[model samples]
Target: MNKPDVSYSIFQDWRANRGNIKAQFILSLFRLATWVRSNKILIILFIWYLPFYRFFVEWVMGIELPWSLKAGRGLKLQHGQALVVHGQTIIGSNCGLKHSTTIGIRMNPDGSVGRAPIIGNNVDIGAHVCIIGAIEIGDNVAIGAGSIVVKSIPPNCVVVGNPARVVKVNEPVTSSYS
Candidate 1:
């Protein structure tokens, strides 16, 4: 038997590693919405998700991710509920977000609305983590449960606690998840 191509194998691996079932469903809907919004031909089909968007956002998945939010490939939602991400926020590939995690905006000192957080690749965000403001979370970083992050985090660090302090640095990214 002939072996599969490298690109096909990589795609299969990505599909296999797409977190839980809930995450897969929500991500599918998000991708559909994004595609519908982008293609002028599918503009008429947007009505399917328009009326039910609030219901899906508030009740079903508890996620408020809009089509404008730029989420990269291999995004994982641990619990896939009560997770709020700002429309302007940018998330990198293979990032895992747990329940009740909010990545939103904050008010600046000049009374202006600040930008949302930019999450890096392979970052694991624990449950109830609130990453606010215009901070940039670096790659291969892990934010512990219930962390209130307001500042930019460097790469390969583990941050925890409220107002999030870096507890560990130069840590390796582990692929195992329970």
Candidate 2:
């Protein structure tokens, strides 16, 4: 929602509730990258990720996270592997992204690049989930694993299956963090 609180320290959040080893590693790298972006004086620190960035993206983490992806505060990576999010994607606060999840873009009929998905606050995306196109996943939505989401989803719903149909609605919004 309202800019999703970017004041908190990502390093502290990772130290407080490090979900898994892979999550810790990825978050650490992401935090370092974010910090480097803010303070240009510390640009030398980016050299640490340059060599391993491709390896982590393709082999280890299996993610395609770019510096342009706008993520809110309290972002959590559950298993932290195979998560592909486009550069134009906007992820909300306290969102949990599991392994093998993809939030990518598609091409428009005019042969131009389409918009990526916009995920709202407190959204829990499960493993092996694919969210494509310019869909808007609303706040508090929980998508089950292996679901392929091609359409926009409303808030406070639980979606599952190949086409990601809403199985339940009006559920409580819960976060993985304490």
Candidate 3:
């Protein structure tokens, strides 16, 4: 992404997290860490800071948004509790994640880790949702609460149930984020 787009994304993140102190602090720290890691000279400092970041964000706050995760701008965290995301996961811009959501990689039978999900833009993930394995969640998708998704979903739809079947297609975004 261009510098302007990055800046816009940062601003959008700020807007998304407004009035949420925990989210603001965590996102700000994540941004700082990401910036530090981008610079070769600052990487050493980031190595030192990683422990504290993990302790505070994971242990204290109960959220596990790693700095290494490639998430786009306007990421919203509602409830901001028990939200875990895999490091290799790629989340698109304007995505909203609720509490107790897990976006993680699956374990192979050979005792190896698999790929994380690639969440597309403008996706709204409800609480207690577990999106596992090497799935691709397309743009403008809404996942219902307590859904367990293990497959790829097409764009512009609403999914529900344990296996996360598409309940509605061409669903319009109800939030002001888009």
Candidate 4:
């Protein structure tokens, strides 16, 4: 029998790393709670109307996210409107995503087709950051108040402005969420 190529072998190895994938999922779920703490009011309201929102998102809105989808414990939504994430997007633990943050692939001729944004841990995405395309945001990335990200962000960095420029790097994020 012929052996698999190096690239093919690496792909197979990645596919077999199910344990790592599950660990990532669990971490994401834990992070969500911290995120919620940072934006407790919004989360509380969402909790209060969870049944309705659940019904709408799961049934009426036609936007489907599977139950098995792993998100960290501290996931907080400062505002809970006009927010959408691609199912394939890999969210890291303790990520804070505000309202109107659409992390998905844009369907345009100039846009790259397929694949979703892979977000890193402890990332704070401010309001209205439309992070489209197949981008990878590293850990501890503090996105500015309003920005559009289409490129990869290195770990321990801060990005701001429209089109999202990396104005600073390795700045500490001080959030109340734990």
Candidate lDDT scores, in order, read 0.78, 0.77, 0.88, 0.62
Better of 2 and 3 by lDDT: 3
RMSD of 4: 14.5
lDDT by residue (tens digit), candidate 3, 128-150: 99999999999999999999999
Each candidate's root-mean-square deviation in Å? 6.2, 4.7, 3.3, 14.5
The sequence of per-residue lDDT tens digits that candidate 1 reaches over residues 7-57 is 333343348345466666667666656656665667675667754665786
Q: Find the candidate with the highest TM-score and give its number.
A: 3
Cα lDDT tens digits for candidate 4, 81-151: 56677757787766776667778876667664767888888889998788888789999999987799998
Candidate 3, RMSD to the unseen true structure: 3.3
What TM-score does structure 2 among the candidates reach? 0.80
Total colliding residue pairs, candidate 1: 0
Predicted candidate 2 versus true structure: per-residue lDDT over 30-116, tens digit per residue = 655555555556557566664575566656767777756788767888766667888799999788888888899999999999999
Ranking by lDDT: 3, 1, 2, 4
lDDT of 2 at 57: 60
Q: After TM-score superposition, what is the CA distance of residue 167 in candidate 2 from its true location, in Å?
A: 1.4
Q: Candidate 2's C-alpha lDDT?
A: 0.77
The prediction achieving the highest lDDT against the true structure is: 3
Name the TM-score of candidate 4: 0.58
Model 3 reaches what TM-score against the true structure? 0.89
Residue 9 error for model 1, in Å?
A: 14
- Per-candidate TM equals 0.82, 0.80, 0.89, 0.58
